[model samples]
Target chain A: MKRLRVDRWTGQLLLARPGACPASTPRTALRPAAASRCAAVRTRSTRAMPEIPTDEDYADGTDHTRFPPLEKLPPRATSLPSPPPERALQSAKLAALHARLSLPEKLPLQTLARALVDNSADENPLFNNTNLAFVGQSLIHYHVAEWLMCRYPRLPMEILYAAMKGYAGPAALHHVARSWGLEHAAAPGGEVDPGLLQFSLHKPGNAIVTLGYKRAEAEGLQKYKWRHGISSRVVFDDDFGQVVETDKATQLRRADTEYGNEYTRSLAEKAYANCARAVVGAIYAHAGREPAKAFIRSHILSRTLDLSALFSFKKPTRELALLCAREDFEFPIARLLSETGRLSRTPVFVVGIFSGKDKLGEAAGPSLEVARNKAAMNALKSWYLYSPGEHVRVPSDMLAEDAQPWTPAYIDMGEIIGR
Target chain B: MEAVVTRPALSCCRRAASSAPSSTRLLLNSSLPSGTRQKSTAARTRRALNIPPHPSFLHPNKTPESVASRPTSDEIIFNPPSSAPSVFHTPFKFLPKTDPRRMANLTSNLFASSTTIQYNYSPSSAASPSAETTTTPSPESFPSIEGPPVLKPRHHLTPQDIEQMRRLREQDPVTNSVQNLARQFQCSKLFVLMCCQAPKEHQQKIKEQEEKVKARWGPRRRAAREERHRRMEMLFNGQL
Candidate 1:
């Protein structure tokens, strides 16, 4: 039989001489014999297996390596040149002084003072409203700017960015722009040329509304990029002032009804007054600040306004409407109309689901009262869809087999764009 | 002294009468509350199981009453159950004394011997040796058998890669169970796992229709798609 011999220490087997038997070497061969004998005996007298060296062994080796033999090194302390005694003493003194100052408690306050002073020099964009616009005509720009300043006096540019982006609307944009102007715009651009006004009002950031028209304009002259901030790209020519006022008035007129009862009459007037003020606040802030840029942004990109306060007003209006409808109150629609005023004059846009014959509705007149009466007549047919029992569905012709579904679109303007 | 001597004598007499063979046992029964004597007899049987026999306590007669009175016969006297077992019953037969009193004795003994050994070769006069060794280190010296080495994590590992690898392994558990594969890949078990794939069940479920999407777009889209496809085929055939 062929046999292999192993070096016991390495656990490696080696070829054995043809004539050699098991006990060829005392050290190597004896280990296996002893191991075999231990297995065979199976008694308490059996010796334990030898341990294998592990990573810890190398760690111990490295630990001992810390102390090198002095004989192997050039005797620098005795033979090599050393620093002069005076210099050494000076260095030791300096090092001691440094060590003493390095403690956290011992740090100098001047460093802290410098950091604080350096931060204030930065340009704060929250103060600049040249790029924002509100949705109201009567709103004095200063009032909106003042409210924004009071509401968020010390907000950083990043926070302002988030608020504007998150709420993106004509109302919110107007508030931001007014605040921005009160804070940033030291000088206003030249007069609004008729051509520039027309072009800019249709651009994003220029006209703040529910459905911004600037984005859909043919020329697309306005850029949508830095409706954000600090893009040295172009000076803005926003026209949210004109576009929003025209479209918004149309929406209000379509939803309003005549207020007959004393209570219903009073609330509708107040809601209208409050909304008008909020719209004015939203618009003037954007107009007064960076009217050009702000107008274009509101009018064009994101097709939204800085009308944050409008949402707050709408909340109560919606609740009151629903409450009046559920209780079958005598003049619920009248109450809604009273607060809303003539829908055409209402500063904010009111949207509802589209159903029934006409796909669009709008109205216009000299006063909001006259305009809203005409618009409400247009929107009345679909009011039942929002009522308790009416079933609402998208028109069969409007459904797409393979496309993302969107919210139903409707118009409240007294103007009938398409029958 | 007389009381002690009479007590033993009485006990011996009791043991002798009780230990008589059965025939004589019945005749010699002393009626001094023999029921109590029966109880004492039972106790003696228990003590025999515990203690080795002592010659002085063994009775001549093996009757129950005589067995009760012998000092060894007093083993028949019932003792209350102990809260802890006797040291003799414990598994550690050769355990060192642990009682505070015994420990004090051992410590004093060690101190006395060590002091003597030192003094035998010293020239100092007498004083308490305990005062001198009070300065030595205590028995709690060895640090809680050094705990296993702790491992710190390497923070430089790429988080994105790790997350991706984890998702991959989670998706393929059947093939990824091998530990060696994880080691070869140098990734954690979670990192080796793959994420769940899109469920076939979702595909099988039917969705309810509300408004058809075409109303949102327009019927012109069909014509648009056909025109685009026709253009594509024409280009593919090198005719466009």
Candidate 2:
């Protein structure tokens, strides 16, 4: 068997497009990208020339096109940043994945292959998942946001953002992709199978999957931990209601983080998330909107997240009172419902918070004060976590061809502000 | 915990159940949801719920007192141990109608463990205590007479009482502290704090004094405090 050419022919492929005679031109100016491995591969290829067929095989008839035959470039492709787009047709794993996900037939294998390549693996936006991920991210966030807003109308902005992150953020998407059971390449290369996810942790990925306004003082959001109001977050933050990280901050983070560190794990998660988004984006691009929405509902929104567990109130009683006052309800009063082991080592008190005749919430705790506080918190949570029926109509449902006449959803007037 | 004491009763149920008509046994074994009920916890919980034990559960030589005590009525009991819930119990989630357990779960456990605590100070139980003269006249006060233990918050404070409490607290916070005001007004300290506040200067002075004390903390102590604060923040963020 003829040993693979490896990365020795990188500069050769870069210089010689299809129909160009590589034998005539001298290997004078090699790209800096191939500078390190170029010399070693050159010597190996020269020695292995006798056994392996020379460029004459390709020049004889095949690959009259501009680029090399993408279908048969695993040997030479290793030298390039990304595998040629045509290589996607020959990837068994890619086809298996397509079948497994039941992706729309219109979404070609080439785009699915391209989705596997992260920006860190291939910088060219044309080949990488950046743009597709961007499209997919927007679509995902929109669907998730509309569903959340309609379902639980009274969630505070902070909790709303948390729920969004829990549903569509990188970590969540990473798990979603993992559930699909796609294998990833050890390292990105043109020689690797198109089906495998390709990413680099050592090199910082520069892909921004969604568009958001990055404020001039974005660094302040990280360094000083300044409180940016919800209004500002709505205007200036990313889709998940997070301050957009400046490129400099990302670079600094990458520099300090060691190999196999949490940052690296995060980078891997983000890449996986991007890949999932790109698949959706490809669907939207190829099939249509309905299929894409169906994909999101099945993959992303179907995942369980306990929204009530997201609340963290500093002054629950005060907040509950404020919420009652704003809603024109009677002030909440906490009454002890029961006490057990009161004079023993561990006392348990159950408290219920009542507003007029209605008992809003109840909780049991180790002490009367703790129980009262917990009950108050529970009351505030119930008020904030109000949900229309699980099947409440979302705005996206209106986008369908046979949707009903739109019904206005009732969203609360933001969270109750406290002293 | 390792005793596994319910087996004997279970064996008796099986023997009695097997001898009962085949139709009744088949009804008892009808079907559970198609899951291999995992682990000992589920098994133990299931065993604990074998209510209205089979007739053969009683030993041949068992005394009359045991049979006499147990109610023969067929009413279902709401008793649940304060531990892992019985395997028959389904949680309050929006389960679809198709779930095999949905029908049973919907019909039961609505008030599971609601009245677990049955002990409260009754009037008869408190007859020995006689501290009525030491208590205030307000009905909201922890009654020295110790009538029935009341869970309801007493709406005994009139507008004048609230106004007077506020006046006293405002005039001299040192004299009318939360504990002192609660004692004088015959209410809870929490109620006293809610009714009024100490002057702004006193609050400021207290805050400043706290700051001074915090400033004097050693570096190790400061770091521990900072770490504690970070953990609390993480707890709120759901990262803890």
Candidate 3:
């Protein structure tokens, strides 16, 4: 098999094969001193070619029986900062990870190895997973957002944003990468195994592998805690419906400290998440969309999240009343359905909110007032939680060849009232 | 046989519905002027039939709900068949009954109760020592001889009202208990306590009253309160 090429933009070492033509010189010019050092190594290696083992000799048990002596190079020897592409084939971890994910045969080990390298580890775009991660992030975010929109059609903008963060956010993706048993290299270098996730914490790169429009007000968002309207967020924010801030430089500076800070931890998390995204991107690029989607479904979408817990209502009763008014339904009335130990310190009062004769929602609380409030909240939740069915088809389902005719999914008129 | 009978009935109903609109339109035309009649009839018919205007038509944007009927029932319960297990239930079936994770999953489910379950208290059980004192009082006898009224407190006190409350509290601290002052001013007991400027002696007395109240609480009650407070703190801190 032809050995993988490390792109020259990385400023890493370009090892020359003994028999390879001298015409295949490095594309980018090295420093004058580094160029002289490379020329010397090349001439010496060519003269010592007779002593080096050939491919055929290594195939037999002769060289494998005894440990080979380590070759010591000069301190200034030029080499790839991250593991070379040639090492991808020998990485047992990479092979095991490939098998564990059950990726298609079409996806080669080289692409998977490249996916493990973060932009920080190798700044070269051609070598790092930045481009692959961008593609993967889009795919993941698209699936996540469409699924969320279809499943919970009536989720308020805030809750929807929270749910997106809970499922497809950096923290969530980091959790996914961790759960897959993918270990990170202590520090990124040519010596580290290609299987491990490689990213440098000390020398961070500006690898914002996300599709989002950085809002005009993004600069002041963190500094002032500027109020961003939900409408604007949909237009300007990332897939998780958050303002995209370009603060990697500040974060990198903070990460330089010996003791790991929040910024450093988040940087690591982003790197791991990007690696996971890059894997998905590599799969999509090789095996096509269907297999990539299936891989995502099994690994990411299958995890359970309680969407109801995302809700935080300020005045549920008022909201319910407004919803009823908008729908032209009967005004909701809270009635005491049941109670126990009414005068006791720990009384349990069950209240039901009803619109006309139909019971909207029911809840129990320590006091009647609290029970009534809870019942109102439940009523609002029930109204908001209307789902056609669990098997409701999303927009992407139409992408399949044999997909049924597109049926427009149910869409609500957003929240009854915004806070 | 049922299909044969229902088919004719359905056809007759359909025919009646199709013909009624035209007849109404004709009636409207005969009674009114040409220009005003067309506009009035269309508006009247739309309202009477509750039919939304065509989207392409030059009309005001109608409420989305106007085109769709509201759900008759508030709750939509989907119960899976007992014989065949649902895909939803399959994920949790692997967990053993003793697993605390299973308990959490069950509690966080849509129908989980917010209130604590009262094991000792039941509606069907005979009146216990606490039951008689806890009987629901009539609205007229809200401030019953047994206890204070369960009315919601209002907190719209003016500056003058606060002054009056302070004066009342200072004159007779013993008589003006926080509860009594709260009831009088239609405010929370805590609010009344915060607003009042009691003398040093009165503050000492208030401390003693607080201790007495604390002593009255049973060990189980105290423990339950503490547990509840701890849980609330954990929830607020996002630790739980």
Candidate 4:
């Protein structure tokens, strides 16, 4: 393979083919030799080089020469908010991370470096990873939602939203980024390493760039503790079914006074989450859908989450009764199946909830009432936790060309009784 | 053609009961004849499999005569008519005894009986049994109540009552219990507790008592309690 060197002043790639150095042209000639010699000199030079050319020097358009002074060129030539794209090649950390993730060869280091530059670090749209992160967020949310829907068809809306957050929310993704052994720059600037995650800690930027419609009452939502219906949230909120608060702009304006340790920590978390999303986005853009989906499944969806613990039942017994009524079954009745040491301080009572002759659920507790309540709760949980099978196919499975004719997935009639 | 068209609309209304409003039902009812409408409504309310018995006038043989005549709803009998045993009843019965899941199932099912019975005996009846018992305590031996205790009506406490309560609390804050004050004032214990102001010393004593009780908990119990609290926090934070 022929080595290529990017011209700093003109922003053009000059290929150095073997035995053809293009010596006849003045500007093109002596480029490869001088670039190689400068690299060797940088390693050997004990003292720092002289100050690089200012922006004016590039604008003056100096005359072409056979031997260009490589040391006089700026350390960073790009005027972008982030480090120059050429730095991606020299970053050892970036190379290690790319290999660690086993990323495809097609996914270039430049895109990976761009993924690390959060919007908070670089406000410029051309340089930052905002667009890539947006694409990644959509793909991640779509796969997660479909999998969760097919896997546990009976999860209530609240539990479903909670599960989605548990898998793909900022805090969860922050943990994902940390597990990848990613290091963040102390502060984001053009001088910082391109490999390190660059995001400002003091200034709270608009880190969340989602394709969601903001409700008019969003301003008053947190301040007034407004009631946002679950259905409304599905329409107006972000992918996780949460209200997308765009108050970060206002918060940033007050950053001088409002900036605290807690605020900075949360900002760091959001920045890390965005970086993870951007990486997924870069994979999709470069390598296409299959690899990106595989990456998400292996990393994010593979994590364990206890779906049963997401329930917070206010009245389990009443809900069970209503469920029986709705299903037109026999009214649920709690009965004491057995007891031991009833008079003792640590008495145990076993209770069972029966619908007709079927023992719906059973549980043991310290008291008869507690046991009965727990039995009722368990019965409701079992009914809600029904699954057709582990390998139930989702809608996305039909996207494959050779997939068999799609069969409709089993969907329950939602929660038996809403709170 | 008319019958075929109406059949789809009728079935549509029936299916719409779950998702649509009752206005569609009203529209369907207006089109139906009164006589058939009542019959259809009754059929819609009936469950899929279990057909409830009609009145005796409508069906004489369907009436339940005794305890055995009616099926008990005490426990659910799977495959009510089938005598075959359920596969789920002993799903892991084939597994080795040392398997954790099998052991859990075994221990859980140890007290899985389907019935409960309670017996009661009178003292006088017990005393007369076998003719060797001592004199039994008669019903009149205990003082009889005239009637049920009357609950004090709300909003009956005067300004003077509040003043007296305050004075009593101020005089002996440590000795006064919220319950005793409530009984004296003929009000709820919560109201009395809210009204009474505890001194700093009393508050400190209460805090010390709570701490003492908490200190008595074993390491395992403490860890379990903390774990429960952490799980609750995770649930609230939507991280679980």
Candidate 5:
């Protein structure tokens, strides 16, 4: 939102040494890269190396383009799996993207360029968006969670998780990134524009696990029908309320995983989603809290996802009855509102659920049972999807300048526990 | 409207003509000239959703101006392809609150074919999410084919009454069917069915009757029903 500053987002990445990036504690030690030799400095010594201790550049055989914009590159710059950090300053596509996003003028092109590089493209954390994406993921998760809880206070835990995934999950964020009109390079190379999202479909990205804890039986959680409740999911699983796939087991399987499969589509989605998170991370890292929240609000939160469409009731009438019993409401009784063509083919019946005089919901169906089920579902949706208001104040609103003193949002007791 | 569009359409086409990659080269991911945005054209040997290219893809990408050229006719009205959304019509719910689009949507009902022929898609409904575009758009949640329902929801059934009703229905399910029991107890047929599980013979009888009814259905009606069933399945799985 501010005018361009000379030393903004670039301060962090600009200071980063080319050869001596932090190789500390890799999740990639298990997954082998086909181009592992390009980033030889990493595969050789992740632990042995100190950060920026030496200025020695790892050299491979190929010549790389350097100065004057026409010269063939030398080995030092081109040999690395991804482009040199200095290249970010000169990239036209990177500059175009920054302008397109209307990103804070404080956010530098170099950090934005770094955000384009997936960890799979370049194992070096300095080159890739891992650190930035980690920060962005947390910020995004926090903002989305607070907004959902505040806006729709009575959402069932199951539905809440579903809503979270619909808003902030990799799939949703993938669409967000796509909407920004970003283009991805075929492969990661110094020759490619820094503006293009660079990733290797052949290799699984070592996306840094930031939000969730790794459970002991994480492998068994997905397999063997191991049932974990919503509370445990909050504590142990990822922010999307799914089992955290940060375990070594998933990573090991991911190594042999080829591109263009169903699994790899999720992998591509993760790559694009992390790219989005990296941009948000870059913003927060530069412009502080308020601008990042503003960006998320204008972009991600503004997308349309009908929350009512997410509900999948096994037995809606039963669930509505249970809900009424829990809330100390009057007993629910379905009444026939209307009917048509009763003696003819394709008869229609209209049913409504009532708790005393209050009409909970209504629907029309081909039969009495179907109509009643639909009405019950509608009533439950109106109950579960209750909103305080469209612009309800989330907890983060308190962090704004000249903000009102905290007025607590409505606290829902919880979803009905039913048999 | 067509005159307004031709100018912008020419400029957009010029951009496409000036420096566009050959169709084969675009797919091959041949080393593109630097700064020329060759989008995610690489490594897409396989895709989960093999979406067909838009009919308009053969031509240059249409600007908003080009969309204005869409013809209006009194006799034979034009509708956008179901797969593709019309550029002129954006559902009010999707637009950001600060968008300049709100003013335009409110002033004109884009769905209206011409000045003489206004579709039920009123400008009021297009401007707000609560517009009465469909039968069940708030106020009248439960709708009938003819008109809004005259009957209202009420609650008077007791637990003891429900218990007695259940016993009587269970005793002679054939004689005390759901519809008969509902009339006797002054409750909905759903309540009668909910309280007492229908006996196997009754359920079998209903299933056979449904099959007999289904047998009379034309191919088009049967296909529609099957499509609906599949849609519900997909909706429950949250794929929709």
Candidate 6:
């Protein structure tokens, strides 16, 4: 058996023979990524002058790429002897450090290999033996999962996560939900159900309905009502000390106020409309496409009627006030009547302020535009409330023929009656 | 000397509504000329230019012929009725007469008697005491009647009565409009202002003055008030 001499001094890979002339052998054979190890191996031992082969001895014609044969290998030579005390100690130390740095079986690539194995599983593979893992296991994965669900509902969740993040990575679903206004509904059996999403806990009663998820309850799981629309109300009262500037202040003081004052009531109405729009946007996230018809009828128009009874004011006062401020009132009234055609009910009417016995002004029709036209006409004519001589005709061609007739009624105009 | 009452100030309340763009405006009625209907080769050539039709105005429903088909309802309920006289000249007596016969003819716990003392007056109730004097006419120095007087029953007031009350309230500087003042006193403005030239803290003063008047006048007034209460209880229970 060939006894290999381990170079303990410099921690080199050495093959040395002891107690006799060393047999000629090539020593510079080891290919380490350093210079000193190769040099040490080459000069370590020499007993071979017999058939020492030089570098040019065998230029292999067969395959120049392959290693040369072993018989024509170089001779090894011995140089300085090992230092007595410190030499062996240093060698042992170096050997230990090298071993610690590069363990024979230490595999750094195992983590990467394991991840890849879990990622690519075979179709219908066995559970334990398979090396596949679902790609989307994190919140980031869910975000991509939801985004894909938005545009393409049937896309695989793992592929979505992988494609969205490029690799299986982190994502935020809440942010995505807010932007698209769609969310997964909570369903039984641990599966997600696609639904028009809403984040609010309060079930708002409105025309639009949001998709919601909730745990099964005694009330039943689907019993969770979702709100997809918004509405606001404003009542005028002296409790606010007559003049409120901001919409926020108006809402804060609705309880103790009277709805008799048109100006404040009008202001409150506008604020409510704005608030309703915001609420609709918040819940369903699509105010543009949706006509908002249901939102108007249910929250604004219906609630205003109920409020009329509560405020002791006539219902028309509140409803017409809202209509007068509607968006489409700017168009000519003739055009409005022409399109919507004749109205069955009088638009909303405001009593004239300048007539001898101020007559009630009548604005009628279902759409908010017609209502405003009638109201504005009454205001312009000062109806029965103002003296005809002093009445101010508002400048607008929007008033239609049906809105022309102003009937006077006997009302005590007080001392300023005809002025 | 009726004081002029100021109009109620406009409230600073915001107008409530989410706005939308105005829809296309159209004329109430206009028909296209018959000649324009013919699609001649030249007209068809012009039509290829794709210019919007000379914006022919039509009603929103696209039918300009029937503008009056839809009659909209006005919400204000208190406008003066048509065919009524232009000037309001009703007498104060037109105000709901609170006579005993009218009161007894009704059916509610409360009735507003024309008398000075108003007791549980539910206008719907129809029980009232009939007070009549059968003896010879009393002298100029007639003795004051004891207890609440059985006044006429005033059921409901007319608009003219309301105006009169408002006018009467306007005469007093310290008083607000009749509508506002009536809300506070829970009564007509005509009578309340009649008692005071200058609006003072009179309720307290009257309570104090009444103490002296009752002491001097003895139990006659107290007995009258008690009778008023009794009549109220009877009226409330449907007991005549």
Best by lDDT: 2
Candidate 6 lDDT by residue in tens digits, A1-419? 96755434432112222312323222223222343321232333444322223445333232422322222211221111111111111122223322332312221111111211110111112211022112112222233233333322222222232344332111222222132322222211101110111111111112211112322231332245432111110122111112222233443354235543544434333222222233322222222212233332233222211110111112323332333333122111211211233354544321111111112232333444334343333332221122222122221212334455543322321221110
Task: Pick the TM-score winner.
Answer: 2
Tens-digit lDDT string for candidate 1 (B18-115) = 78787665654554333233323546567555754442234323355554455553355323432211111111111123323334434443331121
Q: Candidate 1, which CAPRI tier?
A: incorrect
DockQ of each: 0.00, 0.06, 0.02, 0.01, 0.04, 0.01
Q: How would you encode candidate 5's per-residue C-alpha lDDT over A1-419 as one tens digit per residue? A: 97866556554444333434333322233223342232334332223223321224534442322212222232466556887665555455777788789998778776898999999898888789999999998888899989999888878888888888898889999999988888898888876767789888666666664567878897687688788888888788777788766545454466456446666667678889999999999999999999999999988888888887787877777788777777667667777766999888999876766665455666677777677777777777777766656788998988888999997787777777631
Task: Tell me the spans in candidate 2 whose CA falls farther than 4 Å from its real position.
Answer: A1-51, A56-75, A248-257, B1-240
Model 5 residue A64 lDDT score: 24
The TM-score of candidate 6 is 0.16
The docking category that best describes candidate 2 is: incorrect
Cα lDDT, model 6, residue A267: 30
Best prediction by DockQ: 2
Candidate 3: regions farther than 4 A off:
A1-78, A248-250, B1-240
Off by over 4 Å in 6: A1-279, A282-290, A298-308, A311-419, B1-203, B209-240
Alpha-carbon error at A171 in model 6, in Å? Answer: 37
lDDT tens readout by residue for model 4, A1-419 = 85554455332222211212212222233124334311222333232333234547343344324333333323434334577665555566787898899998778887999999989878877888999999998888899999989877778888899999999999989999999989998778655667899987655556456767878988788889889888888788887788876666555655546656566777888888988999999999999888998899999999998776776776677788778777777666676656799999999877666665556666677766666666666676666665555667888778777999987776666677653
Off by over 4 Å in 1: A1-160, A163-254, A258-419, B1-184, B188-240
- For model 2, residues A1-419, the per-residue Cα lDDT tens digits are 98877567765544433321122212122122332321222222222112222455234333333334323343355577777776665566877888899998777887899999999999999999998998999899999999999988877888889999999999999998988888788888777778899987667677677768989888787889887888888898887788877565665466456556676787789899999999999899999999999999999999999887787877777787777777777666677665799999999877666655445666777767666667666666656766656788998788788988997877666768821
Residue B61, candidate 4: C-alpha displacement in angstroms: 46
Chain B of model 6: TM-score?
Answer: 0.19
lDDT for each residue of candidate 3 in A1-419, tens digit (9 for 90 to 100): 97666554332123323222222322122113233221333334333223344445233333522422123122321156787665555466887888788888778877998999999999999889999999999999888889888877877888888888888889999999998789999988765777899998898878779868977777788889988888888888877777787757766666776568888888789998998899999999999989988888898888898765566666667788788777767666676766789888899876766655445666677766666666666666666555555776889888899988996776766778965
Clashing pairs in 2: none
Question: What CAPRI-style quality would you assign to candidate 6?
Answer: incorrect
Which 10 successive residues of model 4 chain A have the least lDDT summed?
A14-23
- Collision pairs in model 5: A63-A73, A64-A73, A64-A74, A65-A72, A65-A73
